[model samples]
Target: MSRTFFTSDHHFGHKNIIDFESRPFSGVEEMNAAMIESWNSVVAKEDKVFHLGDFSFLNRDKTRAIVERLHGYKVLILGNHDRGRSRGWWLDAGFDEVSEHPIVYQGFFFLSHEPMYMNKHMPYVNVHGHIHGQKYEGKSYFNVSVEHWEYKPVPFEQIRDSVAADEEQ
Candidate 1:
């Protein structure tokens, strides 16, 4: 059976991101390789991965090469940095699907590249990326940025359990 995972803000070839996010890698190459390894370690070829945004800063060919190296069927929710290319471009780059805007998954999770406005009164939990190491308060929001997840994707069940736990409080 295939499982779903969420992650974002890889900034694959962006050297500045290492310093910007206080990533521990010595350089961009190391950061990219380590992230790829981390991703493949948990994600299998049959899994589904939703990449929230900022997948990479490399050129099309380079980006495609990196995408091809990862495991799983990938979907991309266009991030602020990803808007430079067309949807078709992302698909061609190895993503199975691309969404230009936020989407609701499994009826309740609002998936986006950036955190959407949500609160306790709202019915939806926002699963998003883009703030990197920072996160918003409340169980209604979950940040899956690579920086927060140890450069790996987070399982959907983990998020579900977190929300469920909060609901019981």
Candidate 2:
């Protein structure tokens, strides 16, 4: 069976990555290339990847090019930055969804942006992006954290252990 992965917040084409605290790249293109490398390193052609949002700083055509270069069947959870251009770009790129809210997959809640509050939640864990740098740390009602531009999936099981460790400390 193919693996299902989740990640987000790769602001490709944003030139000030090094200006940010936790971002390591010196330029946008460098950052974009690095993200692509990281993504392709682990994701296989047959895998399904859930991208939580803030996909690229590139426009629609560039976005399609970048998406095409990557491996996997992508599912987009649209972020605030994902406005304008063409909605068809997303659909044609093989994204299964492009909504703003939660999408369930294999008993997990997928979101592009973070939830406002988690007063009442579901049994499965919630995975999201939007926050980057050191801001990606910490705990919430949701049980997962796949934020930042690292472009790697953090499984629900791993996140559960992270949360448990955080609670113990």
Using TM-score as the measure, which candidate wins?
1
Which regions of candidate 1 are displaced past 4 Å? none
Judge candidate 2 at residue 134 and give its lDDT: 37
Model 1 — which ten-residue stretch has the worst lDDT? 115-124
Candidate 2 stretches with Cα past 4 Å from truth are 93-96, 108-110, 120-124, 134-149, 155-157, 160-169
List TM-scores for all candidates, in order.
0.98, 0.76
Whole-model lDDT values for every prediction: 0.95, 0.63
Candidate 1 lDDT tens digits, 1-169: 9999999999999999988989999998999999999999999999999999999999889999999999999999999999999999999888999999998999999999989988569988999999999989998999999988889999999999999999899
User: What number of backbone clashes does candidate 2 have, counting pairs of residues 3 or more apart or in separate chains?
Assistant: 1
The true-structure Cα RMSD of candidate 2 reads 3.5
